[model samples]
Structure formats: structure tokens, C-alpha cells
Target chain A: MARLNVNPTRMELLNLKTRTKSAKRGHKLLKDKQDGLMKTFMEIVKEAKSLRKEVEEKLSKAFKNFMQASSMMTPEVLESALLYPSAKVELEVKTKNVMSVYIPYFNLKQEGDILNYGYLQTSGELDISLSAFQELFPSLIKLAEIEKQAERLAAELETTRRRVNALEHKLIPDLEDTLKFITMKLDEAERATKVGTMRVKAMIEAAEAAEAAEAAAAV
Target chain B: MKNNYSIAIVGNKETILGFKALGLKTFNANTTEETVKILFELKKQEIVVDEKTGETKPEYAIIFVTEDLAMGISKDDYKKLSQQALPAIVPVPGSKGATNYGIRRIGQIVEQAVGSDIFKE
Candidate 1:
């Protein structure tokens, strides 16, 4: 129902018609893009859900084991045992495009064992905890990957949805309305011109008849 | 260029210093401003490009922020950082003890992934 400030002319009408056509085309393309984004987004979310559950379960177990180990060991012994780490992890991170959004790819290269503590000083639970932690490292990274990917996709989905809605609800409708207004105006102008021509023809015929009657009277 | 992903821990001095012994980098930030600055700096690291393939990679792959310090930041700022794909901002426990923040984050991710809050607690 919003009216555009435009002079209703044939040229403007033609231009608006073309614009509406392109707008419809653009709307369709954007809708398709949104659908594609949502499909991929959902798939990533599903993967992330399972991955999160696994990581959380393992991490909690690891934390519990660590607490148990800490309880058994003396403070000094525990401090020294974990002071020097034996494991070295080099992470290789790259990004791949999912739709228009770039999501991270994490690859870890781990060197050395995680057990740096001596058996004589630390309890078996301590060892178990450390090993569990080492095992959780990659899964942690993978969880980061999946979660980050989901976030990026979610942000994109929000933006795309906004654009699609704008085109579908506001822009396209406005253009169509403007085109209709222009067409109506042009048709009214054409009809007015036709009526004016007929009126001028009648006036000329009436003048000719009057002149002929006056000539007959003079005769 | 080191071909290894750099890791960083951000939190208060006492909590983050422990991570240094493990060969990971640590950033001590007490205020939300400081934490936000550190996060931005880490994300803005120059991308390394491979000579042959022309592929670029991030300098920092994972950044762990203590839950308490992370909570000090505004919600919008935290959400923005989380949405970024590079340098994933992970919340961890500080020295005081574990808050459920880390677990809750994972749970939220689960909900986002699964389209519902399936986790009971």
C-alpha cells in the first residue's frame, strides 16, 4: 500500500516493470540460497550435538579422575609431576567455505607421551587422569571446530533470512504497486486524448454547418 | 610460519599462570576491556599463506578463556567472538573451581545443533 513518489509516465512504467521482473528473479535466487544454507546448517548442527555430548562426558570423567588423583597425592609431588609436560601439540588450522561462510578445519600433530610423572610418586589414578586428558585433546579441538562452524552458519542464516524477507515482503511488493500505478495513469491519459480529438471534430463540423446556413440566407 | 598452532589462556594472573608451565602462552587480563582486547588481538593475527598452494591458515587455533573472566564481558561481545570461526573461544574453569559455564556452553551448542534442549541438566 506504500506509494512511491514517481511521475506516472510510459518510460517510468517500462522501467518499473523490468525492475519488478529482476526483483522477482533475485528473490527466488536468495530464497534458494537461504534453503541451501539452512540444509548445511542443520547437518553441521546435528554433528555438533553428538560431538558435544561426547566431549562433555569425557571431559567430566577426566576432571573427576584428576580430582581423585589430586586427593591421593601430596601437593609438592603433584606440582612437580605436572610441572614439565611431555606432550607437544602443533595445530594446523585452515578454513573451508560452507556456502559463503568460512568454517575452520583443525588438525593436530602431537609429539611425545603425556605421562611425565614418575610411577613411584604418583598414584595410578593420576596416570589414568593424565591419559584421559591426553585422549580428550583432539576431541576438544573437534568440538571447537563443530561449535564454531555452527555459530558461523547461524549468523549467516540470520542475515540471509533478513534479506529474503525484505525482498519478499517489502521491495518486490513496492515495485509491483508502482508499476500498476504507472500503467493506470498511462491508460487514463490515452483515453483523455481520444475524447479530446472527438470533441474537436464535432466543433469543426458544427462551424461548417453554420457557415453553410448563413451563405444560403445571403443567396 | 612455525607450522604449529599457538594456544593461549586468558584469565586472572593466578589462574592463567599455571598454563605457562605446560608450554602454552598465557594472557592475564583482569578487566572485561582487557579480555576483549586480547581476544581481538589474537583474532587479528596475520594469516599465513602457503607458497605453493596459496592456502591461508590462522596463527592461533584455540584460545581458552576462564569462565569467570569470560562472564565479565558483555553478552553481545561474547556472542560475536563465539561466532567467529578462527580462534575458537572456549570457556574453561579458573583456579577458584569449576562453574557450570563450560558445561552449559556445550549444552547450548547441543541445543543449537539439535534444535531443542535435549540435555536434562
Candidate 2:
């Protein structure tokens, strides 16, 4: 890190001292925040991983049934069957702050029967597939909510980590260098003034003693 | 922070019908442009203003797009979709089969956040 390009004055040194003090404080606080964020992030990631696995497994099973059902019926009949669903599902989103990250919570609300279509047009496999998806819907929303939370928390943790590193390594060191330079400069200046005054006083004293001796000789 | 947010899915006829049966809203996109358009529309729906923060946000809580269509979205649009805090864009496999993109995306997010591949082992 480069020393701050500030004039070597006592005022500059005082300013630098304050800056370093604040930087240290900020670093400590950010380190704590980073630790908190990381702990929460790790927990969220673990939960999301397990949920994703379960969701993926269930989804595949439902998809397989869908594929089988699609094969058993004509394209026109299948399209007509699922084109207009009579039921509706909605989501309610709420967030709780964890380490300043707004982690989303999804509450799923379903209205009416999903199997509103007549049984004559659709096959038995289709029924199984739809019901499987019905069971899987809530879990799917929950997975999305948790995964998004993990992403947000991780991102925040990374930013905090960077800030902490900057303060601890770069900014604090630079401030110290500037403060040192100013202090040494002030000390050197003070010593030079003291020595100059002492030398002048010694020369004046010697001149006065010579004049007094000359006057005595003349008398 | 809002109520009555919608959950929707976008994919082809074969993939979307299954979710359609589950009563979630479904949008069928046959082409890349169409898929991008539908996503744009979904992103623009139901704007809500937060009373405390006075910030406007979309009301789409979750939008599940098939991996096939999501991969086809142009680079810029993909960025737009991912950047939104609301309406988490999740990718699922279509009728063709599981491509593992869904799982890989979560890993990617983790790696990006950590700045290293923590799951390398």
C-alpha cells in the first residue's frame, strides 16, 4: 500500500490518526458481520441443497408420468384437456431480515380442485401425474424461497468480507505510514530550531566577552 | 413483503401441462423470442409500492421456467431476469429429461458468492 500523499504537518498527522482509528473500528464490526452472515449462509445452503434434491426427485417422477400419459392420448385431446385449468394458485411473499439480507418466505395458496377437467377426456396416468404435481407444488415454492435466500445471504457475506479485508490490510497500513512520516518531520524541524538558537547564543556571548576586555584595556 | 403474488411457469406444451394441472398459471413459449417476451411480461406484472421504504417491487414471487427455454433466452435478457430480487427465476427440466441445470445453477450461485468452488470436492 502507498502512503497517503499528504503534507508532513502535525495537523495532517492528527487527521491520519483519526482515520486509522475509525478504520480499525470499521474493520472489527465488519468482521463480526461477516461471521454472522457466513454462519447463516452455510445453514441456508445446506437446507436448500436437501430441498432441491427432494424437489428434483419428485419432479422427475411426475414428469415420467406426464410423458407416459402424453403417449397414451392424441395430441389434440391432450392439448384440449390441460389448456384451460379451472383452478388457480397464488403466492404470498414475506421476508425476514437475517444479517441485513431480506430472505424471502413464500406461502402458497391454492383455490379450487386441480382436477377440474372431466375424466373422460384424460387418462388414468394423467390423473396420477397431476396429483403428484399437486403434492409437489408447495415444496417447489419452498425450494425457490430458500434457494433465493441462500443466494442473497452469500452475496452479502462476500461484500462484507471484501470490506473487512480492505480495512485490515490496505487502508490501515497506508494511514500508519502517513502518520509516521508527519511525526518524524515535526521532530526534525524542532531539533533544527533548537540547535540554531544555541549556536547563535554561544557566538554572541564570546563577542560580548571580547568587547568588555577591550574596554578594560583602553581604560 | 407483499401479498397475492402470483406463481407461474413457462415452457412448451408437453412440459407446462403438468404444472397447469397443478393450478399454477402457465405460459407456453415455442420460440426463444416468445419465451423472452413472456418472461418480460411476467417481470412487469403487479407492481407494489412498499409503504415503509417507498420502493416499488413486482408481485411475482416465483416464476419457474423450463431449462430448455431459459437456456435459449438471450444473454442480456437472462441477466435482467437474474438481477430481479422479486420473482425468483427457477429452471426445471422439460419433457425431454433432466439436464441437471437446475442443480448446477444453485452451485453456480454459491460459487459466485464465495468467489471459489467450495463444492469442488
Per-candidate total of colliding backbone pairs: 0, 0
The 0-to-1 C-alpha lDDT of every candidate, in the order given, reads 0.74, 0.82
Residues A24-142 of candidate 2: C-alpha lDDT, one tens digit per residue: 99999889988888888778787887888788888888899889988899988887888788778888778898877788888888887777777897798888888888998889888
Q: What shift in Å separates residue A181 of candidate 2 from its native position after superposition?
A: 1.3
CA deviation > 4 Å runs, candidate 2 = A212-219, B31-33, B48-57, B72-76
What tens-digit string does per-residue lDDT give for candidate 1 at A76-160?
A: 8887876777666668777888778898888877777667658898889877767777777778778777777777777777777
The numbered model that scores best in lDDT is 2
Measured on C-alpha atoms, candidate 2 has an lDDT of: 0.82
DockQ of each: 0.32, 0.65
Model 1, global lDDT = 0.74
For model 2, what is the error of residue A119's alpha carbon versus the real structure, in angstroms, after optimal superposition?
1.3
Worst 10 residues of 1 chain A by lDDT: A52-61
Off by over 4 Å in 1: A216-219, B1-4, B9-38, B44-58, B66-69, B79-84, B92-121
